[model samples]
Target: MLTRLDLMAGAFRAGAALALSEPEIRGLGRLVRQGDVCFDIGAAYGMYTYPLAALVGPGGQVHSFEPLPNPFRLLAAGRRASGAERIRVNNAALGPAPGRELMTLPYRFGLPIHGWAHLRTGQRRPGRPISFSSTRTLKVEVRGVDEYCEDHGIDRVAFMKVDVEGFEARVLEGAARTIDSHRPSLLLEIEDRHLDKYGMTSADLADPLRERGYLMYAWHRGRWARVNSVTTARRNYLFAAQGGL
Candidate 1:
């Protein structure tokens, strides 16, 4: 009863689900129950959102924010196909505060390609002119984690995943209140090269979380690695709040 295209789509979805459902990643999902809320920043194609929605079940909610149009469309389509009604999709970028800013794209991929000018050194591919496109950027509301919880009546957050390109610092800044209050475990992506473009170093990215009582661990070789030096090209670091204060 299924066409070839249907079978292919099913296979693709299955593979995607597996890649995003790794143990370390699913650990966050397991933290969310039937009524908790989770936020997914830069949710490219809802790779993690669908599984998260399943973890949260019918009662919990997942708010996914994507700034770029290409991936945002795919995220929305995936949510629909998965019947993830508890997931709310927002088409805007989150920053330190709420304001419209220029977002640059040099690559077709969903991740941050070329926003930081300093990191632009020698990375540009030859013979490819940087493409410039602008959308009506919206200053979506910004809230610290604590404030967001207070506003939404969220007493506790099971998990928070942040992957805001080169703007992870700003995202963390805005969520300081939440981090300080609820102490929700955080899964963040850190790229040294990307941060270097904004005059930021790896310490600048990790230090704050350390100060906030979060322990840093990297994902590598199908497990969480405690040392960042052990990570590979596909590895990402996870920060777990040690003690809620």
Candidate 2:
């Protein structure tokens, strides 16, 4: 009884809701325990934040960062509505330093794709000239992880989920001290196409994480398989410390 247009609209409407994949939810459950300190970097709309808050329970806390104004509003509202008191929402971008930076936002039908917004960095220029008719840009506040953690007196971070699109390296660079101190397990999203937009290669991603003593793995088939390098083939990666969680 539904037309193609109707179905398409329905899908978009459904996407507006905050939800997480079963595998990621399972992974979080396995990695997080109650009372743990966790972070949701690039948390779009509380998809992972809600679940992480629930997993951490009353004693634990989950700090969620979302830069885009639109999504940040939604995330904050969701946090209040969910009544997940353990989740803290921050409305600033995380990078290697504290300042302001430009962010590129891809659009569709003149509307921004909230989940695809990414920070722009000077480290690498796009390999090829890239442009989209619907694309637009904005400036966002950027904060360093080390400074934020130190200022907040948060010394322990049990788990982190980073989906900064292609700026993962920058985010990690800012968090080096925190990474060194906490050695928290991370769920990172690495896509070659996205990285290429910034003239960066997948190696740029694997190198820093490796330097921090993280071994990458992909949840392939039914098991966690070791990944030696970042290829165009894979996206979501789970990085664990050598010692274990």
Candidate 3:
């Protein structure tokens, strides 16, 4: 009975509500408390950073990362505006090794793309239908999670969100020591299309987490629910360690 306009308006309202209170905060609010530490890889423009800072309070620390130069600048600006001294912003990408890479930044309709920028790891093939109209490149620093955390004296992590497009496996591999030691709950984005660019499958993501004693969860039917496996249909997933949430 709903027209297209009505449907769009409903979707907009839903997004507006989500913007006000992120589902991550609502779902994992109990898990992460005041004074806890958090990480936001692929933080983009601080959409999650600011809200996360609110939940953690001034006592907690939120270390956020953005690889793209433009987004990193914007994220850093938001960090400054927040004046939350504990919220640390890093303009580097976390990967298997600490190095530098020429990451490809895509632009659609003459605007810098927000969600689909990826590391130029291999022979740059024409992305399936090439979502962006044009592209630019930037050399960005890459750090390993365990190394970074150790160097920065970060001994505990209550939560982490990893949304580096299809580079989930590499990120996880780099953070294996950190995950094993801290056992923080993880929110990640891993899509087949993104993985396909690197010749990876969803199982490449799932099996590792399972081996490390993690169960996958997806936000389903308006609530957090367990999922048996990661699939292309569901890109964003929550991984809880040391039992269910």
Using TM-score as the measure, the top candidate is: 3
Clashes of 3: 0
Across 21-125, the per-residue lDDT of candidate 3 in tens digits comes to: 344544555456788899999988775666566667768988999988778898888667656787899999988879998787889999987687888764245
**What does candidate 2's lDDT look like per residue over 61-166, in tens digits?**
9999999989899989877766667889999988899998998888877778776677777636543344545777899999888888898889899888888877
Better of 1 and 2 by TM-score: 2
Tell me the tens digit of each residue's lDDT in model 1 across 110-221. 3444232211222233222344343233223343444455666776676788876546787777777777767776777777656545566567888878887777775555
Best-to-worst TM-score order: 3, 2, 1
Model 1, global lDDT: 0.61
Cα misplacement distance, residue 111 of candidate 2 (Å): 1.2
The lDDT per prediction is 0.61, 0.78, 0.78
* Model 1 spans > 4 angstroms off: 1-31, 107-151, 228-235, 243-245
Q: Estimate each model's TM-score.
A: 0.72, 0.85, 0.86
Question: What TM-score does candidate 3 get on C-alpha atoms?
Answer: 0.86
Give stretches of model 3 more than 4 Å off.
1-25, 122-127
TM-score winner between candidates 2 and 3:
3
The lDDT of model 2 is: 0.78
